[model samples]
Target: RLLNADDPFRKAYPSESPYFTDMGMNTTIKQVEKVDDQTVRFHLNNIDAAFIQNLAMSFASIQSAEYAAQLLKEGKAGDINQK
Candidate 1:
């Protein structure tokens, strides 16, 4: 699972800061069940309605996993960072 100090999706919305860093926080995701080949249930923590909206928007390039990984490896993902 990926863990980080900021919610990367926050860039899509207007915000003064990236995400709260006052104290360590986390959001966890687990594949609880698979509804179908294209769908799955995920368990999460510390998420909210805005986060859900961000998910629907498919944050970042919305490309396949492999391509996204390549962008991240090359440090080009920062180009999508709104902050």
Candidate 2:
């Protein structure tokens, strides 16, 4: 959910978002949906052959939304580089 622009936390910190920018997954994904507890569906805007390959890169990993929530609750959302 953190990657979703409509999500509250993402909206609160626009500059800090790893999504919604050219350098991020925004260009590859047209939309996203939660399929279930263990599944998510990405709707692509176009057929890009390199999409999966790009996702395989280290920076493409999706961070835990719950962890992000924790950061927000603890007022640490601004520190994006913190592990």
Candidate 3:
């Protein structure tokens, strides 16, 4: 899958993908509990170091139920094409 590859897509958007946005992904950051102007706790699924990295790159998505429904409508809920 593309996540395991060194493809341009991986390089361009390694963690949270912008390509998904083009496919109508929701990239909204609704709430950030700011510890300071430069520090905030972001609510995200799959919490990990890479999640922080993805947030720093401005590529994170707050996938609401609506987005999930859209993905299902696209018939690509489980298909991740690497080729």
Candidate 4:
């Protein structure tokens, strides 16, 4: 939901902004699909060998949709990206 036109795909690096791009989300992820309650599918831009390893990193943590939606409703959407 966050990867819409307002935040479209673009290259970013840790040096540029650690809070936003240390894990290279902009260039690496092509799309995301929630297959089921326990599974999520990621459409990657390339065959990344370190994809799993990258996901193990702290920056790759997934946020809860409920909390995100709540924040959006409360007009605190900007806070969602403040990690």
**Tell me, what's the RMSD of every candidate?**
7.3, 3.6, 12.5, 5.2
List the candidate 3 regions with Cα displacement exceeding 4 Å: 1-30, 58-83
Q: TM-scores for all candidates?
A: 0.32, 0.64, 0.26, 0.61
Query: In candidate 2, what are the lDDT values of residues 1-83, reduced to their tens digit?
Result: 44565755555554654433545467668877899988888898888787777777654567787887788888876443347
* Residues 1-83, model 3: lDDT tens digits: 12334533344433555543453323333344769755557554333444444444433433345655664577554422221
Top-lDDT candidate index? 2
lDDT tens digits by residue: candidate 4, 12-53 = 211233533556666778988889998999998988787788
The alpha-carbon lDDT assigned to residue 76 of candidate 3 equals 50
Q: Candidate 4 regions off by >4 Å? A: 1-25, 81-83
What order do you get sorting by TM-score, best first?
2, 4, 1, 3
**lDDT sort, best first:** 2, 4, 1, 3
Is candidate 2 or 4 superior in lDDT?
2
Candidate 4 residue pairs in clash (backbone atoms < 3 Å): none
lDDT of 1 by residue, 49-80 (tens): 55444445423123455655665676665444
Task: Please give the CA lDDT of all the candidate structures.
Answer: 0.43, 0.65, 0.43, 0.62
TM-score of 2: 0.64
Total clashing pairs for each candidate: 0, 0, 0, 0
